[model samples]
Structure formats: C-alpha cells, structure tokens
Target: MDKKQAQALGKLLRLSREKAGLSGRELADRSGMAASNVLRLEQGTIANPRPETLKSLADVLDLDLSDLYAAAGYIQPEGLPSFAPYLRSKYSGLPASAQRELETSFAKIAAKHGYDPNGPQPGEDETE
Candidate 1:
C-alpha cells in the first residue's frame, strides 16, 4: 500500500478497534497476535498484511471481514453504499441519531429510484 493508503487503513483499524472497546494490547491478546504486530498495523508500519492476519483482527474487532478487506484495499470498489452504512464504515464517530437520519433519508431516495429494499437481494439464489 502507498503511504496515504496505509495511513488511512491504520486510522480505520484504530478507529474500529476503539469503537469496539478494545485496546491495542487487548486486541492482540484476543486475536492471538503479538502486541507489536497489532501496534505496527495501527501505526501503519506493516504493508500488505496476510489475509489470516486481517481475519484475526476482524474477528476480534467484531467486523465483517469484507469491511476490513475493503478498508485494506483488498476488494475492488463497488457502487456507492447506502449513506448510513458508508458513513458508519468510514466515520465511526457519527452519533446514532445522525446515522438514523441519514439512513431514513437514503431510504427515501432509494425508493424514489425504484430500489426495493424488501426484494430479493442482488445475486441471491432465487431457486432456493
């Protein structure tokens, strides 16, 4: 990862950890990784960490592996996420009320665009 991406990844990791109420050392212990490695990741010293390492961190932090992978730039960016989810992922500091408001507004816009929230999910197996 480039310097800027590394920095952003580190910040995202750190913020996610803090949001989950885990200290770096606690995360290390829970993830069964060395404290220094966790510190290095949060400090942006490690580039291109192994998938298992990211999985461990994600598990310990209660994050979806895909979300962690996306933040780590492992996945190709897709279409825009709904506003509430995008904000929650990138800005964990947002207050709950504000997030709910954005979700409500985004739901309205999506409905106007004919996106049915209750319909079969994208790529879902309809034959099941």
Candidate 2:
C-alpha cells in the first residue's frame, strides 16, 4: 500500500486499540512485541507489518483479520465493495458531480450506522 494508505491504517489500528482499552505498551506486552515497535506501527513508520505480527495484534485486540485489512485499504468489505468497483459497475461514465453525490450518499449511510469515515469517534484517548 502507499504511504497514505499505511498511515490511515496505522491510525485506525491505534484507534481500535484505544477503544478496546489498550495502551501501546500494554498491547505490546500482550502481543509479545516491543513497545517501540507498537509505536512505530501506529505511527506508520512500519508500513508493512508481517502477517504473523498482524495476526498477533489482532488476537490481542480482538479484531478480525478481514476487518484489519479493510481498515488498511488492503481489502474491501464484503457487503460494500470497493468504491472503485462500485463506480465501475454503476457509474463508470458518470460525471464527477455524480460521483460526489454517490460518495455523499454513502457517507450519510455510514454515519447513520455509527461508522465514522473520518476516523474513530472524537474524544477518544490515544493511550488507554
């Protein structure tokens, strides 16, 4: 993934860890990783964490592997396919404004369902 994607994923993972009441050091202890490594992962300095490392993290954080991948933009969700695929299937020839409308609609739906496309909920603690 690109640097931006990696950064986004790292942010998401950090949020998830905090929401689950885990501190970076605590997560490291549970996952058998170094605290510095955890910090680097959360900071996107380590863009490509090993699959086994991710698995260990998921196990400690109680997250599904697919969910983690989706957060990283590595894989799309099952029900709501990737935006690229969706656009190609339904509005490949549409104007930019139409695409904007589609994105807006999807954003509304996601927000209504308590999913924040911007990131995790506000006022969330970064360190648990």
Candidate 3:
C-alpha cells in the first residue's frame, strides 16, 4: 500500500487503541512486541507489519483479523478489491464522540476554504 494508506491506517489504529484504553506499552506487552515497535506501528513507520505480528496485535486489541487487515488497506485473499466502503460504513456506527471527531475533522477542512463553523463566509453564495 501507499504511504497515504499506511498513514490513514495508523491513525485509525491509534484511535482504536485509545478507545480501548490501552497504552502503547500495554499493547506491546500484550502482543509480545517491543514498545518501540508498537509506537512505530501507530506512527505509520512500520508499513508492512508481519502476519504473525498483525495477528498478535489484533488479538491484544480485541479486533478481528479481517478488520485489522481492512484498516491496513489490505485486500482479503478471496474478497473485494477494496474494503474502504465497508470500513467507512462500520466507522459510521461508532459512538457519538467518534462521530464528533469525524465532524470536527471535516470542519477543519471546510475552514480552510473560508467557511465558518456557524455559517457561510461573507459574500459567499448560499447555493452553488
């Protein structure tokens, strides 16, 4: 996978870990991986984690291997070309806080285009 995909996966993994209330060191210990390795994984520095390592990480994180693989942008051996649509739909079902974070991220993006959080910018057309 490309760097962008790796980065996106890393962000998702980090968020999952946080939501699960596990520190990097704790996850590392549970997975029998080095703490630094776990940190690296969360930082997208380890783009291609080994299958065994992935499995171990998934086990500790209480995640299905398929979900982890999908997060990492890997196509299942016998399935679709992309799991993004599935992942997106699943992510949409997360808790309110998670949804708020997603909304905030989009708000930041919109802000860059001169749109205010409350409404349109001055002189901006209401309908495009």
Candidate 4:
C-alpha cells in the first residue's frame, strides 16, 4: 500500500476500534494478536499487513473485511460489491432480525459517511 493508503487504513482501524469501545490492547486480546501488532497497524507502521491478520482483526472489531481490504488498497472502492453480501455470508448464525438490523445500520452509516452512492445525497430530499 502507498503511504496515504496505509495511513487511511490505520485511521479507519483506530476509528472502528474506538467506535467499538475497545482499546488497542483489548482488541489485540480479543483478536488473539499481539498488542504491538494492533498498535503498529493503527499507527500505520504495517504497510503490508497479512489478509488473515486483517480478517481476524475485522472479525473482532465487528467491521467489514472488505472495508479493510479497500482501505489497504487491495481493491478499488468503485469496483467493490455491496457490503450486504458480506453481512449475509458472515452472520448466517445471527437471527433474521439481527441480520436485518445490521443491514439497516450499514445502510445508515454508509449514507452518513458519504459512501453509499445509491443513498440520498447530502441535502437531497428523501421524501421526494
């Protein structure tokens, strides 16, 4: 990954960790990884992190792996598939309502973060 991409990935990882209300050490423990590994990734020191490592961290962080992959410059965001498929694949054990809630939350957050191209744009009237 380029320097900027690594930095963005690190920022996203830190933000997601904070959003999940977990410290770096806590996330490392839950993910069965070293605390320094998490710290290095969050500090953008790991320019070429392993996919499995990212997957494990994402699983623990309740984050979409594809997002991490995209942030890591492994894939282009425009070519990215809808994230809903990922939720379905990973959370088949979740109750139907819970899966639906995840979908709803994903959509809302995607829109809020300006990543959902199909969602209503800023200042666009949704009631139209």
**Which pairs of residues collide in candidate 3?**
none
Encode model 4's per-residue lDDT on 12-122: one tens digit a residue.
999999999999999999998999999999989999999999999899988888889988888545644567877887798999899899999988987798784465566
- TM-score of each model, in listed order: 0.57, 0.54, 0.57, 0.61
Pairs of residues at least 3 apart in sequence or in different chains that clash in candidate 2: none
What are the per-model numbers of colliding residue pairs? 0, 0, 0, 0
Residue-level error in angstroms, candidate 4, position 29: 0.5
Tens-digit per-residue lDDT, 1-128, candidate 3: 66776777678778878988999998889889999998888888888877788888887877788877887777787844333344455587787677667767776887788765555466675666
The predicted structure with the larger TM-score, 2 or 4, is 4
Report the alpha-carbon TM-score of model 1 versus the true structure.
Answer: 0.57
Better candidate by TM-score, 2 or 3: 3
Instruction: Estimate, for each residue in 21-118, the C-alpha lDDT of model 2 and write its tens digit.
Output: 99999999999999999998899888778777887898888888766776555655456666645665568688888887887888788879987654
User: Which segments of candidate 1 are over 4 A away from where they belong?
Assistant: 76-128
Off by over 4 Å in 3: 79-128
Better of 3 and 4 by TM-score: 4
Selected candidate, larger lDDT, 1 vs 3: 1
* lDDT (0 to 1) per candidate: 0.81, 0.79, 0.76, 0.87
